[model samples]
Target chain A: MPVQLAIALTHLLSRKRQTLVSLTGIVLGVAFFLAVSSLMRGSEGDFIKRLIDNSPHITVSDEYRQAQRQPASERWPTGAVELRRVKPLTEVRGIRGHPRALAYIESLPGLRAAPVLVGSVVLTFAGRIEGVTLNGIVPDKMKQVSTIEDKMIEGSLEQLAANPNGIVIGAGLARKFGLAMGSVVNAASPGGEVRTLKVVGIFRTGNANYDDMQTFALLKRAQGLLDRPNRINRIVIQLSDPYAAREVASIIERGIGYKAVSWLEASEDLMSVLLVRNLIMYSVVSAILVVAAFGIYNTVSTIVMEKIHDIAILKSMGFHARDIRLIFLTEGVILGLIGSLFGLTLGLGLMALLARVELKPPGATELVFLPIYWGYEQYLLAAGFAMASAIGAAWLPARKAGRVQPVVILRGMG
Target chain B: MNPAGREGSPPMLTAERLGRVLPGEVPVTLVQDISLTIDRGEFVAIMGPSGSGKSSLLYLLGLLDTPTAGRILLDGRDTSGYGEDELATTRLRQLGFVFQFHFLLAEFSALDNVLLPMRRLGALDEGSAQRRAGALLAQLGLDGQAHKRPHQLSGGQRQRVAIARALANDPPIILADEPTGNLDSHAAANVRQILRDLTRELGKTVIAVTHDLTFASAADRQIGIVDGRIDPHWRA
Candidate 1:
C-alpha cells in the first residue's frame, strides 16, 4: 500500500465512532436518493405509456392550421392595404377527396390510418334523453388504429359489420339507458334524420367521462343518418414506433394539406409539468447528499485537529504538504466508495420491496403494484453525486492539514 | 583537530548570517544573524540556557523552517531559493531529525514508523526498505520492540525508534534536539554513546543541541549560545 493511503486508513480507524457515523450518513443518503428517484421515474414512465396507448399517435384533421390567403393578397404580393376580419369563404366541413388522402397516407411505411366521421347525437330511450358523440368507423380499418376493440365488455366490433344498424355503446351509457345487447333506441341528428339502432357491443374504458359519452357505428349507417355521405373530418393514425409520431405527423400534414396533431404535441403541457417535477425531486434528493457531506467534513476536520503534532513530525520527516493533504482526501474517498457500494444494494432491496406493495386507488377495479424503475443511469448518478460530495467536503480540511508549519507546532510543543 | 573530522574537504553545512523573526504586533526574533560551519563527519554540540534559540537554529539548518534572511548551503549548494516542495525533497534525501520528544506516530508500529522516510524518498523498493528498517532497529538494540506502538514502548525504546527512523533514508547529516532530555541517566548515556558512534563508525555529521554538560563534552566541539547569539564566555 502507498504510505499516504495507509496513513489515511490508520487515521480513520483510530476514530471508529466518528468514522462510522459519517459513513452511515452517506449510506442512507445514497439509498434514499436511489429509491425515490426510481419510483418517480417509474411512475412517470407508466403515465406516459398509458397516454400513448390510449390515444392516436397522430390525428390528421380536415382543417388548416393557418387561415387561407385571399385571392387579392396573393395577387398583390406586398399590398399596402392590410385586411382585417375579412369573411372566410364557406364550404362543406369535411376533407375533400378523402379517399385519395387516405390512400396517400397508407402508402407510408410502419403506420396505419383510418377515417372517422364524428357527430353529436341525442339518443331517446323510453322517456330519457342523453346527448353523446357518435363515431362512424369501418371495423376492419378502425381496429388497426384504435384500442376500442380491447375495451369491449359484451359484444365485439366485428358484430357491427354483420349488422348494419348495430352500434357499440359505453358501459356507462348502457347502464344509464337500461339498454343491453339487441335493445333498440332512437338516435336523432340535428339534420332532422332519425334512426332506431340496436346496441351490438358494450365497452368500459376506465374513464367515466369517456365511458358515458362515446358510441361507435358503421360508416355507411352514420353517413346516412347525419346526411354527410362520403365525407370524413378526421384521419386517426397509429405508428409502430410511437416516438416517431411528431415526424410522421409533419410529413402527413405537408402531403395532405391538413393540420396533423401528434400525441406528444397535444400533451406538451403535461410533459413540462413532469420536467418541473423531476427538477424538484433531484434538488430534494441531492440535498441529502450535501448534508451527508457535512458529516465527512466534521470527521476529517476533527482528525486534522487531533493529529496536529503528528503532522508536525511527518512534515519534519520530509513529507510534503501535498502528501499530507492526499492522506486525508483518501480517507473521505474511501468512506464514499464503501458507503455507495452498500447503499446501492440497500436501494435495490428497497425498490424490490416497493414493487411488491399493492394498492387499490379510489374507484379502481383492480389492485396495482407500485412502479420501480431499474435503470442503470440512476445508480451511476447516485454514486457519482456521493463521490463528488465527499471530495468537496474533504478538501477544506485537507488544505488546512497541508499548511501546518513544523516550526510553529514544535515551538508550541516545547 | 578532531581525529574523525576531514580537515581539508569542504564543510558539509554552512549558515551565512541566518535570521528568523516571528512577525506580529510585537515582532519576536527566534534566531538572528547566526553564522557557522561544521566540517564533514564531525560531532558538534550547541549548548545554551533555555529559550536561547538552540532548537530554532537547528530547525533552520535542517531545512524544516525557512530563514527570514540569509542563506543555508548543504554540500556547496545554496538553498535560499528553494521552494517548499524543493526543501522537503532535500530534507527527505539528505538530512534526518530527532526531537526532544520521541515524536513517533502513535497509530503506527515502530517498524512502520521507521519505514516512513524511506518510503517517502522511494530510493529503495519495498522489500529493501523493510529490510533496512529492520536492520537499523536491530542495530539500535530495538529488534524485539519493532512491532510495538509508541504508547506500548518505554521512553528509552521510543527514542531509539526515533533514531532508527532518522537513519531510514541513510542521510549524511543527523540533527538532534535534546535527544536525551526526557530519558533517565542510564538511557541518556546509552543514547549519547549511540550518537557518538554514528560519527566514528559511519562517518556521519551529527549536530545536537543539549544542556547536559557531559553530553556536550562527548562532542568534538561545543558552540555556546546566549540570547540567540554565539557567546564565548557562556558556561553551562
Candidate 2:
C-alpha cells in the first residue's frame, strides 16, 4: 500500500472510539434515510394506483370546449362581428354522431371504451325516497373498462344485460332502503317517466358516498326511461398504460371535437400535493445525513490535532501538502464506505420490518400492511448523499492538514 | 570552489545568502545572510548555542523550509523559484533530513519508516524498496529491530532507524539537526561514528547541528553560529 493510505488507516484505527462514533452516526443516518423514503414513496405509489384503478383514465363528455362559431362570424372573416343577445337553440343535451365517435375511440390500440348515459333520478321504495345518480352502461364493455364487475357481492353486471330493466346499486344504498336482489324500485326521471327496476347486483367499494348515491343499468333501458333514444352523453375509457391518458385524451378531443379530459388533468391539485409531500420528506431525511457529517468532521479534526508531530515528520520526509490532505480525506472515505455498507443492510431490514407492520383504520375490518418501496434507486441515492456529506465534512480539516509548516512544528517540539 | 569543491568534486549542496524571517506583528528572523557550500564526500558540523538558529539553517539547506530571500542550488540547479510541490519533489530525490528527536513515525515499523522515502520517490518497485530498506537497517546495526515500532526500540535504536530512513533513497546530501542530542553518551558516540562513516565509506555529504565538541571534532570542518549569523572567529 502507499504510505499515505497506510498512515490514514493507522490514524483512524488508533482512534477506535472516535472512529466508531462517527461511523455509527453515518450508519443510522443512512439507514433512516432509506427506510423513511421507501415508506413515503411506496405510499405515494399506492395512492396513485388506487386513483388510477378506481376511475376512468379518460372521460369524453357530450359538451364541447367552445360553442360552434356563428355563421355571421364565419362569413365576415376579419370584420368586427359583435352580435349581442345570442342564445343557443334548444336541443337534446348529448353528443351528436356518438356512434362514429365511439368507433373512432375503440379503434385506438390498448384502450377499452364504454358509452354511458348518466342522469339524475329519484328512487322510491316502501315509501322511502332518495336522490341518486343513475349510470347507463353496456354490460360487456363496462366489464372491460371498469372493476365494478369484480366489486360485485351478490350478482353480476351480466345480469343487467340479461334483464332489460335490471339495476346494480351499492350495498350502502341497498341497506338504507332495505332493498335486496330482485326487489323492485320506482325510478322517476326529469321527463316525468317512471319505471320499476329490479336490483340485480349489489357492490361495496368501501367509499360511503359512492355506495350511497350511485347505481348502474343497461344503456338501452336507461335511454328509454330517460326519454332519449340512442344517446350516450359520455364515453368512459380505460387504457392499458394509464399514464398515457393525457396524450390520448388530447388526441381524442382533437379527433372527435368533443371535450376529453384525462384523470391526470382532473386531479392536478392532488398531484401537486403529493409532490409537496415528497419534497418535505427528502428535506427532513437529508438533515440526518448532514448531522452525521458533522460528527465525521469533529472526529477527523481531532485526529489532525493529535497527530501534528507525525505530520511534521512526514512533511520533513518530503511528503507533499496534497499527500497530507489526501491522508486525512482518505479517513473520511474509509468511514463513509464502512458506514454505508452496514447502513444499507440495516435499511433493508428496516424496510422489511416496516412492510410487515399492520394498521387497522377506523371502521375497517382487516389490517392493512404498511407499504415499503424496494427500489434500487433509493439505495443509490442514499449512498451517494452519504459519501458527499462525509467528504464535505472532511474537507476543511484536510485543508488545514495540508497547510502545516514542518519547520515551525519541529522547532516548537525542540 | 564555484561548481565543485577544492578537489574538483561537484558541490552537492549550496546556499547563497539564505534568509528566513517570520513575518508577523514583530518579525523574528530565524536565519539571515547564510552562504555556504558543502561538496560531495564532506562531513561538516554546525555548532551553536540554544536559540542560535542551527536547525533553521539546516531546514533551509534541506529545502524543508523556503528562504524568504536568496536561494539554494542543489546539484548545479538554482531552486529559488521552485514551488512547494517542486521543492518537495527535489527533497524526495536529492535531500534527506534527521531531526534532534528520532522522529520515526510511531505507528510504522522501523523498516516501514525507512521505506517511506523510497516509496514516495517511487524509484524502485515495492520488492526492491523493501529489500533496500532492510539492507540499510542491517547496515545501521539494527538487523533484528527492523520490524519493531518506534516506541518498542531503545532511543539509540530509533535514531539508527531514522538514519536508515534518511539513507533510504541514497541521496548524496543528508542534513541532520542534533542527530545525537537525545542519545546517551555511548549511544551518542555510536551515532556520531555512523554519520562520519557515511562520508568516508559512501561518499555522502553530511551536515549536522550539534553542541558536542567531540562530535564537532569528528567533522571535516566546523562552523559556529551566534544569533542566527555564522561566527567566523568562534571555534569548538
Candidate 3:
C-alpha cells in the first residue's frame, strides 16, 4: 500500500468511536435521501400517467387562433385601409368540411382522431328534469380515440350502433332518474328539436361531477335532435406516444387551420407545480448530506490536531506537503465509499418496505401500495453527492496538516 | 581531526553567512552570520546554551527550513534557487535527521517507521525497501523490537529505532538534535558510541548538537555558539 493511505487508515482505526459516528451520519443521510426522492418521483410519474391515460392527447377545436382578415385588406397591399366598427361576418358555428380535416389528421403517423359534436341538453322523464352535456359521437370512430369504453358498467359503445336512438348515461344520472338499461327519456336541445332516446349504456368514471352531468349518443340521432347536420365542433386525438402531444398538436393545427391544444399545454400550471415540488424535495434531501459532511470535518480535524507531532517528523524525513495532504484526504474518501455502499443497501430495503405498504386514500374504495421509483440515476446521484461532500470536508484539515513546520515543533520539544 | 575538508574533495555541507529571523512587529533573530563546513566521514558536535539557535541552524542546514539571508550548498551545489518541493526532495535523498525526542509515529511499528523515508524516496522497490529497513534495525541492535510500536518500546530502544530511520535512505550526512537528551546514562553512552562508530566504521558524516560535555567529547571537533554566533573560547 502507499504510505499516505496506510497512515490514513491507521489514523481512522485509532479513533474508532468518532469514525463510526461520522460514518453512521453519512449512511443515514444517504439512505433517507434515496427513499424520499424515490417516493416523490414515483408519485409524480403515477399522476402524469393517469392524466395522460384519461384525457385526449390533443384537442383540435373549430376556432381560429387569430381573427380572419377582411378581403379588402388582403387585396390591397400598402393601401390606407384602416376599417373600424365594421361588423364581422356571421358564419356557421361548426367546422366547415370537417370530413376533409379528419382525413388530413388521420394521415399523420401514430395518432387516431374522432370528430365530436357537443351541446347542452335537457332530459325529462317521469315528471323530472335535469340539464346535462350531450356529446354526439360516431361510435366506431369514437372507440378508437376515447377511454369511455373502459369505464362501461352495463352496455358497450357498440350497442349504440345496434340501436340508432341509444344514449349512454353516467351512473349518477341513472340513479337520479331511476332509469334502467332500456328506459326511454326525452332529450330537448336549445334549438327546440326533441327526440326520445333509450339508455343503452351506463358508465362510472370515479369522478362524481363528470358521472353526474355527461351523456353520449350516436352522431345521427344527436344531429336530428339538435337540428344541426354534418357538423362537428371538436376533434379529439389520441397518440401512441403521449409525450409527443405538443409537437403533434402544433402540426395538426397547421394542417387543419384550427386551434389545437396538447394535454401538456392544457395542464402547464400543474406541470410547473410538480417541477417546483421536485426542486424543493431535492434541496431538502441534499441538506441532510451537507449536515453529514460536517461530521466528517470534525473527525478529520481532530485527527490532524492529534497527529501534529507525527506530521513534523514526517516532514523532517522529507515527505512533501502534498503527500501529507493526501493522507487525510484519503481518510475522507474511504469513509465516503464505505458509507455509500451500506447506505444504498439500506435505502433499497427502505424502498422495498415502502412499496409494500397499503393505504386507502380518503374517499377511495381500494387500497393502493405506495409507489417507489427504482431508477439507476437516483443511486448515482446519491453516491456522487456523498463523495463530493466527504472530499470537501477533508480539504481544510489536510491543508493545515501539510503546512506544519518541523523546526518549530522540534524546537518546542527542546 | 580534519577541520578543513580532505585535500582533493569538496566538503559535504557548506553554509556561507547563513541567517534566519522570525518576522514580526519586532523581529527576532534565531541564527545570524553563521559560516561552516564539514568534510565527508567526519564527526562534529555543536554545543550551546538554551535558546542559542543550534537547533535552528541544524534545521537550516538540513533544508527543513529556508535560510533568510544566506545560501546553503549541498555537495558544492548552490541551493538558493530551490523551491519548497525541491528542498524536500533534496532532503529526502541527501540528508537525515534525529531529534531530541524519538518522534517515531506512534501507530507504526519500528520497522515501518524506518521504512518511511525509503518509501517516500521510491529509490528502492518495496521488497528491497523492507529488507533494508529490517537490516538497519538489526544493525542498530533493535532486531527484537522491530515489530513493536514506539509506546511499547523502552526509551533507549525508541531512540535507536529513530537512528535506524535516519540511516534508512543512506544519506551522506546525519544531523542529530540532542539525540541522547532523554536517555539514561548507560543509554546515552551507548548512543554516543554508535554515533562515533558511524563516522569511523561506516564512513558517514555525523553532526550532533549536545549539552552533555561527555557526549560532546566523543566527536573529533566541537563548535560552540553563544548568542547565535560561534564562540571559539567555549569548546569541549
Candidate 4:
C-alpha cells in the first residue's frame, strides 16, 4: 500500500500544477480545522479553570435563613443577630449549633469545609472611598480550597499570623488607590463603623476582573468590623477531587436542607457563553470545511478526467474496476494524511507564535499581561476532522470513476 | 468448421452476427452482423477502407463491447453469457489487442507499459512482472529502450512497446486494429515482418487490421471488408 501510495503521489507530482492546487486545497482544509477548534476549545478550558477558581469549592449558605441570619448561640440576648455571606437566598443548613461544622464536613467522606466570612464594605483611604468584598479566612483553611496562597506576590502567611491588624490588598486595587505594604486603609462596615488595617501583602491573581475587587483579612477582624462576632455567613466546603463540586453541593443541598451552590449556579452567564462560543466555532469551522470539501471534489474529479486516458488504458489492460476505485479512494486518504501532518505542524506553529504574542489592552498602561491560552489535544481532534472531510469529499468522485465504461470510452476515443 | 484443423483443437475466437450502435443524437450502426473466426498461431489480415468496420470488428472480437446481436465464442464457450467481470477475465487470460496509435501510457517507461496488463491482472508481483516485461521488450528489439518513455522513444520503438504489451499475458490470440497505420514505411515494413516472424517463430496467432497490401500479403490469410461486411470472395 505504501508503494502504491508513493507511486500515485509520484504520478501526481509529475503534473506539478495540478498537484499544487490539490495539495493547497487539502492543506487549507486541515489548517482551518485545527485553528478554530483549538481556539474554541482553549477558550472553554480557560473559562472552566477560571470558574473553578473564582468561587468556593461548594457553598451551602441559606435556603431561607435570610442574608444576615445568626446562629442561636450568636444571637443577641433577645434579638436575632444579622450576619450572612453576600445576602442569603433562603434557609439554614445542618451547621446550626454545630461549632465543629468544619470537622464534621472533613469527616464526611470526600468533604472538607472551611469557614469563610464574606462581607462587603467601603474602604476609605486618603479621601477616596471604594466599595469592596472583604473575604475573611483562616490562612490554612483558605489554602485548602483557594488558589490564593499560590498567587501572593509578597509577604508570607506568617506575616499574616504575626500582625493582628494584617490584611492583603489586591494588586489592581493597590495600583488604583496608591496603597502598598505597610500603608493604612480604613475599612468601614455596612453599618457605618470604621476600622483601620495595615496592608501586609498584595496578591496579583492573573484574572483582571476578580483581582480588582477582592480584599482579605483575619476572620476575627472581619467579625468585629461587620458587628457579627462569633457568626459566619457560610461554611465553604472543599473536596479532594474537583469534580466533587457538583456532587458534594448536591449532597449538601439534600442532606443539610439548604440550597447548595456550585460554580455553575453562581456564574450561569459565563457557562452559557462558553457553550455558545463552542457552538459557534464548530458551526463556522465545519461550514468552512464543507466549502473545502467542494474544492476536494473539484480537484479529484478534474484529476480523474485528466487521468482518463491512463484510466482507460489500465481498464483495457485488465485492471478491475474495483482496484481502480480503490486507487482513487486511497489517493484521497493519502491527500488527507499528508494534509493533516502539515496542518498539525502549522497549527502548532501558530499556537506557539500566539503564545509569545503580548496582547495589550487598548489605551491601558504596560502593567497588564495577557498570556495566550491553549493546550495540545486540539491538534489531534482537528486532524481527525480534516481527514474525515477529505475522505467525504473524495467519495463521490471515486465512485464516478469506478463506474466509467471502458468500452464506451475507448470506442468514443477511436 | 473445423477452424484451425490443429491438434488439441487450438482455441479459436469466433464472432457471429455482432453489431455495434454508436451513440449520437440518433444512433448510427457502425457495424452489423459481422462474423469471423481466427485460430491460434495464424497470421491473419483484415483490410478495408475507412468506416468499413475493420476496427469495430477487432473491438467486438476482443470482447470490448456487448454485441447488439448474436454471440462471440472463445474456446467454444459462449461469451455473450459472460458478465462484464467474466468478460474482462477472459480478455486478460486469452485475448490481447494492439491499436493503431499504440496507446502506450505516455508517462510510463516502455518496460513498465508492457508490464501494465499483467500488473492489472495481478498475474505476477512487481519483480517477476518486471522480468517478464524485460524479456518481452528484449524480444521485440527494445532492450535498453525499455527504460524510455513513449515520448522519449521513436515511432518504431513505441509500436514495439505496444506489441510487447499485447504479448505480456501470453494470450491465445491478438487483435490489432491497423498495426502499421501510424508507422513510416521502414517501421511499417519492420512491424509487418515482425508479425510474420511472430507466427513462424513464437507460434502466436495475430489478427491485424490494415489496408496496406504489402502488410496484408505477409499474413497467412487475407480477408477484405467494405461497407461493414467481409467480402472474402472479393480480391483486388
Candidate 5:
C-alpha cells in the first residue's frame, strides 16, 4: 500500500504545475477553517467564562411584577433580560451555625450557591476616587466560581483579612486613584453612609466592566456599610448540569420566596451576540469552503482530461475504472490533509500573534486585550469540515476520469 | 471446413450488425451496417481519409464508443447489453491501443507510463507491474530510457515505450489509430515492426489505421473505408 501510494504520489508530484491550482484552493479552504473557526469557538468559550465570572449563573434576586409593561432598560440594564424583580427575604438564612444562608441553597440535591451584596457607591481613594459598583462577596466561594485568585495582581488573602477595614480594588480602579496595596479607600455604602478600607488586593478581570468600575470587599464588611448586617442583595446557585437550571431554579423558588433565574434567561443579550457571532463566522468561512470545493473539482477534472490518453493506455492494460477513480480520490484526500494541517499550523501562529494584540475598541474608549480563544472541539470541527469538503469535491471528477475508455482517448478526443 | 469451427482459429473479437445513432432532434447515424471478424493472430490495417469514421469504428471495436445498430462480441459475449463497467472491464483486460502520436503521460517516466495500464487495472501488484514494465521496455530496447519522461525521449524511443504500454496487460488484441502518423519514417518503421511482432511472435490480433501506404502495405490484411463504408475491392 505504501509503495502504491509512493508511486501515486510520484505521479501527482510530477504534474505539479497543472495540479497547483486545486492544491492552492484546498489550502485556502483550510486557512478559512482554521481562522474563522478559531475566532468563533474561541469567542464562545470566552463568552461562557465571562458570563459566569461577572454575573450570577443562577440568581434569586428582586423581581418586579410589571416587568414586561416597564421599559426594557428600566428594571434591567440594556444588556440584561427584562425580568420582574421579586425581592428576596434578605435576613441571613442559615443551615449550620454559620451566617451563610446560601449554604442551605447549596445543600439542595445538586447545587453550589454563593451569597453576594451588590450596589453602586461613591468611593474616595487618595482623594482621586470615583463612583463604582461595590461587589460584596464571600471570599472563599468567589474563588470557586470565578478566577479571582488567578486574577489578583497585588496583595494576598491574609493581607485582605488582616485589615478589618479592607477592600480589593480593580487594577484599573487602583490606577485611576493612584493607589496601591496598603492604600486606603472611602465609599458611600448602599445606604449612603461613609465606609473606609485599606487596599488589600488588586484584580484585572480581562474585561473592562469588572476592572474599571468595580470594587470588592468581604460580605461582612458590605453588610456594615449598607447598614443591613443580616441581609444580602442576591443569592447565586450553580447546578450539577447547567441545562437543568430553569427547572431547578423553579423548584428552589417554590421553596423560597425569591425569584430564581437561570443564566440563559438573565444573560439573553450576551448569549445572542455570542451565538450570532459564531454563526456569522461559520457562514462567511463556509462561502470560502464552497469555492475551494469547486476548485478541487475543477482541478481534478482538468488533470483527468489532461491525462486522458494515459488513462486510455492504463485502461487497456487491465486497469480497472475503480482503480482510476481511487487514484484521483486519494489525490483529493491528500490535498485536504496537507492544506488543513498546514492551515492549523498557520492558524496557531496567527493566534499567538493576535494574542499579544491589545485592542482598545477602535476609539477613545480603552480596552486592554483583543478577545479570542479556542478549545479542542473547535479545532477538530474546523479540520473535520475542511476534510469533508475537500474529499467531496474530488469525488465526481475521479469517477468521470475512471470511466474514460482507452479507445476514445487513443482516438484523441473525437 | 466450416469457417466457424476451424481448429486453432478462435476469434478474439466479433461484431454483428453494430450501429450507433446518437439521440438528437434529428438522430444522426454515424455508421451503417458493418460486419467483420478478427482472428487470434493477424495484423490488419484500416485505410481511410478524414471523416471516413475510421476512428469512430475503432472506438466501437475498443469498447470506448457504443454501436447504434449492432452487437459486439468479445471472445463471444454480445456487448449490446453491457453496462459502462462491463465495457471498461473488457477494454482493460483484452485489448490494447496505440495512437498516431505516442500519448505517453508527460508527467510520468517511461517506466511509469508502461506501468500505467496495470495501475488502472489494479490487477497486478506493484512488484509484478514493475517487472513486466521493465521486461517490455527492455524488449523494445528502451530499458535505459525507462527513467526519462516522454518529452525527454526521442520520438522512436517514446513510441517504443507506448508499444510497451500497449502490451502491459498481455491483451489478445491490439488497436492502433495511425500509430505511425506522428513519427518520422524510422520511428514509424520501428512502430510497424513492434505491431507486426505483437501478432507474429506473441500470437495477438492487431488493427492499425493509417494513410501511410508504406505502413499499410506491410500488413497481412488491409481494408479501405470510404464515407463510413468498407470498399468490397479493398476489403482484404
Candidate 6:
C-alpha cells in the first residue's frame, strides 16, 4: 500500500468509535434516500401504466385545430384581406370522407383503429330518468381498440353483433335502474328518436362515475335512432408502443385535417406535475446526504486537530504537503465506499419489504401489493451523490492539514 | 562571511549569512547574518541562553524553515532557489533532525517509528526496511523494546528511538536541537555519548544546540550566540 493510505488506515483504526459514527451517518442517509426515491418512482410508474392501459393511445376527433382559411386569404398569402359580415358554414357533426381516412390509418403498422359515434342520451326506467353517454361501436373493430370485452361481467361485445338492438351498461347503472341482462330500457336521443334496447352485457370498470354514466350499442342501430347515417365522429386507436402516440397522432392530424390528440398530449399537465414532484423528492433526499457529509467533516477535523504533533513531525521528516492532504482524503473515500455498499443492501431490503405489503383500496375487490420500481438509475444516482458529498466535505480539512508549517509547531513544542 | 562546509573533504553541511525573521506586528529577527563552517566528521555544539535563537539557526540549517535573507548549501549546492518540494527532497536524502523532545509517533511502535522515514523514502523493500529498523533499534541498545509504543518506553529509550528514526534514511548530517534537554542526568549522559559516537565512529557530521556544559565540552568546537548574533570572544 502507499504510505498515505497506510497512514489513513492507521488513523481510522485507532479511532474506531468516531469512524463508525461517521460511517453510520452515511449509511442511514443513503439507505433512506434510496428507499424513499424507489417508492415514489414506483407509484408514479404504476399510475402511468394505469393511465396508458385504460385510455386509447390516440383519438382522431372530427374537428380542425384551426378554422378553414377564407378563399381570399388562401389566394393572397400575407395580404391584409378582410371581409365584412361573413358567417361560418354549419355542417353535420361527423368526419367527412371518413372511409378514405380509415383506410389510410389502417395502413400504418402496429396500430389498431376503430370508428366510434358518441353522443349524449337520456335513459328512462319505470319513470326514472338519468342522462348518460351513448357510444356506438362495431363489435369486432371495438374489440381490437378497447379492453371492455375483458371488463364484461355478463356478456361480451360479440353478443351485440347478433342482437341488433342490444346495449351494454355498467353495473352501477344496472343497480340504480334495478335491471339485469336481457332487460329492456327506453333510450331517447336529442333528435326525438326513441328505442327500447335490450341490455345484452353488464360491465364493472371499478370507476364509479364511468360505471354509472356510460353505455355502448351497435353502430347501425345507433345511427337509425339518432338519425345520422354512415358517419363516425371519432377513431379510437391502440398502438404497440403507447409512448409513440404523439408522433403518430401528429402525422394523422396533418394527413386528415382533424384534431388527433395523443394520451401524452391529453395528460400533459399531469406529466408536468409529476416532474415537479420528482424534483422536490430528490432535493429533499439529497439534503440528508449533505447533512451526513457534515459528520464526516467533523470527524476528520477533530483527527487533524489531535494529530497536530504527528503532522509536524512528519513534515519535519520531509513529507510533502500534498502527501498529508492525500492521507486525509483517502479516509473520506474509504468511508464513502463502505457506507454506500451497506446502504445499497439495506435499501434493497426495504424495497423487498415494501413490495410484499398488501392492501385493499376502497371499492377494490382484491388485495394489491405496493409497487416497487426496480430502476438501476436510482442506485447510480444515490451512490454518485454520496461520493460527491463525502469528497466535498473532506476537501477543506485536508487543505488545512497541508498548510500546517512545521517550524512554527516545532517552536511551540519547545 | 565564510560559508560552512567549504574546507577539506567538503563539509557535509554549510550556511551562508543564514537569517530568519518572524514577520508580525513587532517584526522580530530571530537570527542575523550568521556565517559558519564545520568539516566532515566534526561534532559542533551551539551554546546559548534562553531565547538566544540557537534553535532558529539550527532550523535554518536543517531546511525545516526558509531563511529570510540568506541561503544554505548541502554538499556544496546552493539551496536558495529550491521550491518547497525540492527542499523537502534534499532534507529527506541529506539531513536528519532530532528535536528537544522525543517526537516519536505515539500510536506507532518503536520499530515502526524507525521505519517511518525509510518507508517514506522508499529506498528498500518492506522486508529490508524491517530488517534495517530492527538493526537500528538493536544498535541503540533498544533490542527487546522494538515493538513497544512510545508511551511504554522510558524517556531515554524514547529519545534513543527518535535517534534511530533520524538515522533510518542514513542521511550524512544529523541536526539535533537540545537532544538531551528533556532527560535526567543519566539519560542525558547516555544520549550525549551516542551523538558523540555518531560523529567519531560513523563519520557523520553532528550539530547540536545545548545548555549542558558537559555536552558542549565534548564537542570538537563550541560557538555561543546572544541576541541573534554570534559572540566572537566566547569559547568552551
What lDDT does each candidate get? 0.91, 0.90, 0.90, 0.75, 0.74, 0.89
Better of 3 and 4 by DockQ: 3
Q: Which ten residues in a row have the lowest lDDT in candidate 3 chain A?
A: A359-368
| Candidate 4 lDDT by residue in tens digits, A228-296 | 777667778766676777777776665655567876677778878778978888787777667766766
In angstroms, give how far residue A358 of model 2 lies from its true place: 2.0
Docking class of 2: medium
In terms of lDDT, the poorest run of 10 residues in model 1 chain A is A359-368
Better of 2 and 5 by DockQ: 2
Evaluated on chain A only, model 4 obtains a TM-score of 0.83
lDDT of 5 at A206: 63
**Model 5 C-alpha lDDT versus the unseen true structure:** 0.74
Candidate 2 chain B weakest ten by summed lDDT:
B1-10
Cα-based RMSD of the predictions, in order? 2.5, 2.6, 2.7, 5.9, 7.0, 3.1
Best by DockQ: 1
Cα error, residue A349 of model 6, in Å, equals: 2.1
Cα lDDT tens digits, model 6, A1-414, are: 777888888898899999999989889888888998998999899878878877789999988999988899999989999899988786567998888999889999889999988888899998899999999999999999888888899987898999989999998999999989989999999999999999999998776777899999999888777777898898999999999999999999988899999999999999999999999999999999999999889888888999988888998898889988998888888888787888888889988999999987666544778888889999988888888888888888889998899998999998
Q: Report the C-alpha displacement of residue B74, candidate 6, in angstroms.
A: 1.2
lDDT of 5 by residue, A180-255 (tens): 8888778886567897788899887666666878777887788778776756767767666776777887776666
Per-residue error for B175 in candidate 1, Å, reads 1.4
Candidate 2: clashing pairs of residues: none
Q: What stretches of model 6 exceed 4 Å from their correct place?
A: A75-89, A125-128, A152-154, A171-183, A202-208, A359-367, B1-9
C-alpha lDDT of residue B201 in model 2? 88
What TM-score does candidate 1 reach? Answer: 0.94
- Could you give candidate 3's per-residue lDDT for residues A1-414 as a string of tens digits? 898988999999999999999899889889999999999999898778767877789998878989877888899967879888989777657888999999999999999999898888999999999999998999988999888899999998999999999999999889999988999999999988888999999998766677789999998887777777888888999999999999999999889899999999999999999999999999998999999999999999999999999998888899999999999999999989888888898989999999999887653434779878999999999989999999999999999999998777877777
What digit string (tens of lDDT, one per residue) describes model 6 on residues B66-133? 99987887777788999888978887887888988989988889999999888899999999999999
Selected candidate, larger DockQ, 2 vs 6: 2
